[model samples]
Target: MTSEVSRRDFLKASAAGAGFVLTFRIAGGATSAAEAAGAWEPNTVFTIDPSGIITVHITKAEMGQGVGTALAQIVAEELEADWRDIRIDYPTSDPKYGLMLTGGSWSVNWTFDALSRAGAGARHLLIEAAAKHMNEPASECIAEGNRVRHLPSGKFLTYGDIVSKGLITATLSDEELKKIQLKKPAEYKVIGKWIQRLDVPEKTNGRAKFGIDRFLPGMVYAKVIYPPTRTGSKVVSVDDSEARKVKGYISTVREGDIVAVVAENYLAAVAAQGKMRVTWDKGPHANVTTDSITQDYWNKAKNDTSAPSWVDVGDADGALAKSMKTHEAAFWTDYVGHAPLEPMNCVARYQDGTFDFFSGSQFQTRAMGDLSKLFGVKPEQIRVHQQYLGGGFGRRLEPDVMLEAGLIAKAVGKPVKLIRSREDDIARDFYRSCTLQVLKGGIDSSGAVIAWKNTLVCAYPGERYGGLDKQGRDQFSLNGSDHYYDIPNQFVRAIRAETGMEVGYVRAVAPNYTFFAVETFVD
Candidate 1:
């Protein structure tokens, strides 16, 4: 069966307003990495009807990440249940589940314990209920292959028949709960064993529906109008009269101040949008060039001193002055964007005041909450179907695509599939933020770095961390120092650029720029 989470429902769950509580609990005894779903909670997985199917709601988004299958293994391994009879689905946009996303290689490692425990708890309840139905002592019953079998009579009951309304009606006492034994690593039949991906066959054969391929019953395709600049600029005037004259074009709507939504066939939409003449406010950034941006970084790094302390080994200042020699250098890196092959696309529909989104994303929960706030709806009302992403590398996780799709759909009253062309994607994209850095260091006679400091001495500043106050905001460093080797006394500092474009995540985040400064400068 397909997933039930709609786009609007997902957005709501993400924000976590209303009475929606996404509780998580760990089971009694299971060894796995911590799940992203906060503290673990039992009773996380439940069946809809007994004897129908076993469903586990996992938090991780699957973008060829193998999160769907791995999470099932967590459940089946712990429950010692039948793997063939189970199906895994995405959780609702609940605060508990929505924020629990699968990215940054944090999938199996994150949900291992919480999901296993949820499975183990469900497994135990099924076993106990089956034992009671068979008129046998639970002590004499063994749970295996979704059946709780009585040793003496070989009597058994399937999980479906054992559970009512998918609820664990038979609650184990605290003592009974403590006595519950989870499968050990040695007893594992599902996890820690070689297994094929469940969705790979469908994917390899072209049967899997990617986010770009998703469509609603009656959906119109739309294209975005991207200006050659960043967000927050105002649209002075847009002349869509010429665009409306195109053959396949239906209409052009000003979805956002700087965005125009054009609905038509692929070639027709491009032909139509190309004809539009738009004028902007030509804000302050209009005159700013990339060269000027890098220049700002140089000045900031030269004066930065407020770098946060990541680690401290010894007296870094004193050793640097006494060192046999000191060295310093400057470095620069050009900005880059993720530019995934599939680009960005979303299928959105709003009916009965609820939003439904079908897109590929790393943050299913975050999507719901962000949308709820954007649309002024309850989080639970948004349903998100996190389709298989073509490629993320962290790009599709942004709110821009999902929000725009929803707005276009809401405007048209028909489900709309919005996408970006290769050119449009790049022009409206965010990059790794170009940087210029200067490093200064001192090495002792023994050839060890004693004191090291690097500043964002370039045209632009680094991440504008919300935690820092206004005075502390502009001064930025991609990251603090990481002196891997032993240094008797060493420290690094951050200096912010006085001006430039906003800085954001690129690939490995701040570490890339920071590492270059420390490693290259220390020598």
Candidate 2:
């Protein structure tokens, strides 16, 4: 359903809730007073410069999920404009507007307000800009296409013409951010319609540029010698003297974490890399033999009393002891990957004033912050260009991949294009956190649950509530909501233990794991 929140009209919108490469922005937390008044944190930079062309900055990077197009449709609808004659651009990856991250399925959800606000605000300003040309009050004007109309006279002034006179330069206040009117669902035109994706043409016509295709004049080549395994490994030593003797081989470099090649050309880079040899300090997981992350999850699930408790309804112990039968189940899940076909790679350059970076990240703000922290530069100097992800099944947040490119660029003092091997991708993803749900439910002969006891252990990393971390967003809460099937007694206790690997959010998060355990227990 739609609201006065035209996807384009700017909304000081914030999601109090939780997309396509299949994600939505994680939209919930304690609601603040500004939020209660419908103010969302502004993340987009919408401006139509001195020229007539609209240069709206999109916050979400395209990952073949249609976010770029979907987000624009909302804005155009509010601009009451046609896509055939519009220009949209993504934010430079930096914190000025925000880094363009295409993760968390938040492309659409996150922009609800910002887009709505951007659209309504833009159109409002455009109308105001138009009204100023006509010496008419903005209230007397309504916009149609690029023209703002005076209802009484039925005459109109074109936005382009108004711009020819002068573009509006007003800024938004806290009150304006909250005060803008939004479009209701009944009136939505461009959004929620079967709008075609904009990236399709570039992809079809071969005009599209991916990270691997990023190149400029005098760009040399590189090849990374990946560690043997994913979790913990290191480069023990390297002998590159032989490579140095080869033609086209320039020089080699090594730092704290990585060691690799630098050459004059692509084939030279390849030949040089092939000639070099390296010894690695492999990790324990080097012997990783099975799809079974099952054991690790279960062992960690045992019992951690300090685990956050999300649900408790009745006296679970007493009910279970008093019940006729108890049903117990421990669900074991397999570790999964964000296995997008594109794998992982990044393009980086350290110039005089800025560290220019290009990669796929789910959190642009976080990525920029991470790089700034690493380089000891002001966040403003670093520019992150959020690009289309070939496919990001949640694998984009590994920041290590982006970091590798950044590190190499900083080390060499030249722009570097970094691409991870497929094996590099598979072996090194912040994989989906598989879990073991140890559940105990008591039931009477009447098929009524007398008590429910569920102990949960986080297999993945978690989200922050009020900037504080909690067990993977509690899934048991959904079941505990009503015990859904009228379970008279229930106690859902969760135990969270730290996984050795860095675990973070994956699709469906807690609800999927919790529901699998919950629905099975009910059945």
Candidate 3:
């Protein structure tokens, strides 16, 4: 939505708390902005200024998902604010935001209720203030089109007019916010209707800035020469004498098995990295191949009996055993990479005691925490200037790529832009683990599925990220196996396969493979 409000106006409104500054609590029980100044929650914080410009600061990562638009609509629908007056802003990562992550399609679903209340709360205050100004009963006043309308009097006050008069001062408590009546589904005016996506204009006009588009003055370029194995190995030696011959070549920074070749520009860095000679002690995993991983999954699925069932219903074992009509099938899926068009890139700067990361990250909170732990600094010392991502598909969730840029920047003592070549990006990607699913289905005489059994084997995606539950089960490895069918008996279990390599979540996570096995077996 287009707005005449300038950036100066937004800043002044935020500073003065001009109109209603609505704040909702985010995850991890973080307090609202009104409760504590700096202890801000990662919620939809929208400000209605004196000019009637509504600025909604969306904290979720907007990686090709219209989450920004959807969430804004949720606010506008309840606030009765005009769509054209809305403006969206992506805020940077901070402890106040509390676990800024964008994945699993959780952005809108988790925030809908909270944001609706915030908007409704602000609207309630606006109506009260408008009733006082118009000398009308608050019950008869309704908020619509960014203004308060008195039904009988046929008079209205624009949100800007009421805000400019400094009339809305009452705060909405958690209890009061809950008591406010929200709009019904049929009464929704902004949500569910197709409005122009907030990010479409900037994206279509090439004005959207991705992680790779970020640049700073005097920032050098870096290209990483990864260890021979994807899991990483120790560096044996480095002979960059030949790389010195390349034009614009700067130097090399080494951390463990990884080496970053720095140069004046990306082209120079790539050329120099190609010329440089570095030997790696590719550990035991050097011999780990796709075939080996697949075989490991097969072995685990066939023999691992101690593996616990992630989803168990009724008596699947008895049904499959007693049933005469049974079908069994095996499905295998190879490792798939999240090869987003933008590849992996980040601009990092470590100056004084602060570490700045200008990157499009899906998990900004994790990235900031990772860099803080890696550099031995407090979380407050790190700043993540979140940018738009070309695509995520679960790749940007990992902080390894961003960590490399930070490590390189700190080594050189200058702002460094690390860009990965397409080849390098694919080669070093944390691929979706190769998975094997052996499914068995038992059908009745009437051809209805009576029993279902599935044994999935794959390297746990969460194993590398410390996401495993107490029983040592990674949900990503077993998702989608628990079918939604009305089958009376179903048993789904997972056997962990040690691929000795890091695996990650891709587009649909485990469902991509799990559903294939389950549906195919039923067929």
Candidate 4:
């Protein structure tokens, strides 16, 4: 995972060979002679073939967010490539693609400039190639509709003709890439305009490949009997005699806390799963309930003074004591689940110390690394293929299902497609943290609020999911509490309480709850 190639390393390794194929060096480089040959396929991101087709490798997962379309628009706007000729595909798990994550509403915001620069750089190279063919300056040529046109004489050359004729050979350096001029917002032909979504056609035609739709050549179907609780739950025993009576039942896999029933097909797998009897130790969380969580968070919000202060300004205690009026309020929100349209599913194949996975993952790069450690193999030994997500809603960000599929595939010695039923998905999901907020405010004689204090108590999403900020705090649980008001004295803090329940980033994360409390108090 630490072997990620830097920008300089990528530029140095990339070479434009004859026949118009651009070879990009990834983690292990080219493994075969065909790849090493001048076939000219770009490694992971965007690439132009000799035929002038612009293939864009989208790193973000398309979870009904139009990310694929928005990203393509950004690239096409600067690349000046024909929209009709543009195609979109997902990249494999490789560090060369950068942080292959697609949540927190960051896909377009993070990639806007980088993708634009990449397009502009590619356009610059194409124009440079056309300049040599026309014997004109690169500045005098304009790229339009996949063709470079000399403005003086109106002579044009297609990108394919120039590239195939060996006119484009130079690749941009990191400095040159930085220096490339990007188009202003007013000049964006694709970004601001309404273009049809790339995924719409496939979805309309029923040809889209969701995680559940994944099928491998020798793949079997698997279904698990999950414990009541995610943590501190262990399988005590399993009786599969009844499952063995099923016609298509293949085998039962028991690894750690996971108990899976494998069959020749999905129906048989579900049927066999229904017949299997399993016993489990419910552990400490067996007694935990929703009401108990509510009471625990409320208590922490009122009394937890040891909580870290996320924001503080002046002395709120002195200001509130001297104020003529004071207001106090508390707000709470129950835990919720990201009930995406499609249930969790992953297809995995393990063989010869290598693993291949197919699923809709928001964090494929992280998944590859985690799976490598879980399987005790190198990062390169795992290949994660992306698929269209029916809906992520921040749920697909975790790769628990992918790991389960890999483990089952390894146990059965065959490709296995593990699918979670609706009930299983809902019951086992990493839920949004139930929150409790306490706010205290002070107002002067003029009714101008001079001081504010807020305390939040909730499960730490980062602690549960391992994405803590540099301050060693789960910012996800404290967002939106910091107000923009001109209060002279303000204090904001969060108490990380253990609810004995799993928590993760839902669509808006902590902002949803924090903003609700702040806005309600202001009104």
Residue-wise C-alpha lDDT for candidate 1, range 1-523, written one tens digit per residue: 0113443453353343221222323333322222221212245453323453666666566666677888778777877667777776665455554345544465665455545555666667767667777778988998788777999999877665554323234554545544556667887788878878777888889988788888678788777776645744678888888888888787777765735545656677778778888888766677677667765565456544564444445766676678899877778877777788788888889899999888887666557666787788888777887677787766765657778888888887888888888887776665666667656678777776677654454323222212343344332233535546666665544444433344445545344766776676654
Using TM-score as the yardstick, the better of models 2 and 4 is 4
lDDT of 3: 0.79
Question: Which candidate has the highest lDDT of all?
Answer: 4
After superposition, the stretches of candidate 4 with alpha carbons farther than 4 Å from their true spots are 1-44, 464-472
TM-score of each: 0.82, 0.82, 0.88, 0.91
Measured by TM-score, the strongest candidate is 4
- On lDDT, who's better, 2 or 4? 4
**Measured by TM-score, how close is model 1 to the native structure?**
0.82
Question: Which residue runs of candidate 3 sit more than 4 Å off their true CA positions?
Answer: 1-44, 133-136, 151-155, 312-318, 444-449, 464-466, 486-489
lDDT of 2 by residue, 122-208 (tens): 677778767776788889989867578998888787655555554454545646756878989899877888866777888999888
lDDT of 4 at 378: 88
lDDT of each structure? 0.63, 0.63, 0.79, 0.80
- Please give the distance, in angstroms, between residue 370's alpha carbon in candidate 2 and its true position after superposition: 0.8
Better of 1 and 2 by TM-score: 1
lDDT computed for candidate 1? 0.63
lDDT of 4 by residue, 251-357 (tens): 99999888999999999999999998999899888888878888788778778788789889999989999999999998988888988999999999998998989
